[model samples]
Target: MADVRLFPRLAAVHARRLLANPGISTGVDPDALRSAAEPFVTWAPSGGRRSTNAELDRLRDNIRAVAAACGWPGPAGQVSRASFDAGMGAFLLESGYLPVAEALRDDVWSWIAIALVPDVCLWRFEGAAPERFLGGRRNTLQRLWSRARVFDRGPGEEDRWELLDRLTEDAMVQITERPSIGADPKLAAAIGEAWVRTAAEVGASAMEALTREAVRNLRITNEVLCFGALGDADLAAAVGEHFQRAAAATASQTGQASG
Candidate 1:
């Protein structure tokens, strides 16, 4: 993979317009969209240190090849989230962290989703929300990169992708998007382990309810606690306590409702 570079910041304006076009959201001719996007993309200094149009094409081709290899079929074809996640994870690892991180800007992602690989975006997102084209925690490429970065535990560790396998999509998104969790691998894994256990013990629906509460508790706890300063063991212990409390509260609510 080539080093990823960013387009000029002003390109974001044009990128947004392209994304806003309804035709692109449903699906557009990839070649046509690429042509439109070409004008807005301005490579960085040092002879396009940021990504070039050609690089974007290469990246899209690479994703398609990986998807095909992994059997992650497109919209008209059968699709598996597990296959897609695994394939994308491998791609991210190969792409290297620095270049991928540098290209994570909203504008860059926007251009890529709108022009480079809108089909993949539609396939992954089911052609629903515009966030797939725009930028956010839920942006297709951004989400994939963020998930891989957060859960990667290095060699000889548990496969972090299992978190995606276990958690509900909403749960995974909530957990992965938070700064405290997403930015720290150990912390994310710790919480993810706890969440998986909780889900297995209490069922997915109850676990999701508990997870919402846990997210709220995390926000409040972070106000006084320096989670970044804590070690893995300490963070896990803290999250464990919160999980227990949330689980208990969820159980109590369920009991009351049933009664």
Candidate 2:
């Protein structure tokens, strides 16, 4: 993934744009955006990851420190559904438009993926994965379990998450739409329900399942002009065929270029 300090760049550009066009609302609460960006610039952990008997354990401790400061429970064994949902809501409400804004700033899809994970984990783990580190079972923790598989091998910061790589130009534009401000809340809820049901059955974390489902649903809905018809089996097949064809063409182009 590209090194994208999305908030910094957006701050400068948006600030200038606001000055010149005061009437144009960013659709982002300005103060919330600033607060979200603060961690990116100022929250570097000192003495970074160190060589210890259990590397994952150390990482978990680091995360717990962060979660504790954010008023989350300190142990995975202590997590409950209600606590998890509350933290998730708080993070989501506080998140404002930083995720979209950052994605726009980076001009890369990865920023959105990076931004979403921590917030998603707020709900997915309810603040417990950190404690899993102590058990040497960090691989079973929701965020880590899902994310670790994304990196088969890596150059540290290189993102191996192909799903994120597939978020096309148009998808990002549509996703970054001011959903919080004007999108039908029912649609979002339905999407979330569809995601949780489908994902959990497949042993996917909510974030992983939702991200994939959201992208797939968005592409199909946009192409068919009918999110309303996602349940229509015939229309879904047609939209799926469209996705397959596009994927094939992209693969062919890449092969030809490489050849």
Candidate 3:
């Protein structure tokens, strides 16, 4: 766990300007991007440390190495989504919390996506919005770091990994973005398992509707309930009830439509 620092702040205006440029967005040579981005970065004074130019380069190298070891068979573009998820998840787990936290910042991640790994960004997010390079949620490295932070529930948690593997990309994004459940590991796992079970019991069409409804209901419940006070079983039961209601509603809708 190295002491991490904040990346020098790039004003929102400047950041948008950079992202709007066709050369940066369309993908330029990594060296050229780095040189262009260098002037905008200022290392933090203390508390956290900024990633240096050399450190960013090392990170890129490490990403490639990990991809290779994980049998990703890259050029980055060729890596399967599942393989990329697993490999990046493993990388984030090994990266420790501090670096991951720093990487979460839009400034740092923007630099990484736009300057360091633009090719990977373009490849992985082809035809996607520019936000893929500029936004925290869509940034390639930031999203992986976020996924690892939320789902990699630590030692003796192989079951968590399995649950994660079972999730659709849409499901993963949904669960990860929900602050009410995403911030709590127990809640996240319980909700995930419950969602999977509900999907199994009702099938995919119902599951999508159920998931959407359940998440909406849960968000409302979260406002009034102190979910943290509930034990694991209770929390799980609470989540299950939401899904059960959603399933029932979805079934009714389907029946009426068929009728």
Best by TM-score: 1
The ten-residue window of minimal lDDT in model 2 covers: 107-116
lDDT of each: 0.70, 0.34, 0.69
Per-residue error for 178 in candidate 1, Å, reads 3.9
- Please give each candidate's TM-score: 0.81, 0.25, 0.80
Q: Which stretches of candidate 3 lie over 4 Å from their true place?
A: 1-11, 48-54, 65-79, 97-101, 179-186, 203-206
Candidate 3 residue lDDT tens string, 133-185: 77477777777777766666577765546554656676776677777778876
Candidate 1, residue 77: CA error in Å?
9.8
lDDT tens digits, residue span 1-259, model 2? 5232222222333333322332212222333433453354321233232223243234334444445654544334333333333332233223332243332223111212122223323333433233221212121122222222221223344433322233322332233233431143333333333333343443343234334444554555554465544554554454444434444454576579899
lDDT of 1 by residue, 1-259 (tens): 5644555432557867776677865656878877877777754555336655576567788887766765545443433665676558656664673365455667656766777777777777675477777666667776777776666656566664676556666777668777766766666677777888788878887787899898789878878987777887888889888898999999999999999
Error of 1 at 185 (Å): 5.4
Model 1 alpha-carbon drift over 4 Å, by segment? 1-10, 47-55, 69-86, 179-186
Rate residue 153 of model 1 by lDDT: 58
TM-score of candidate 2 versus the correct structure, residues matched by position = 0.25
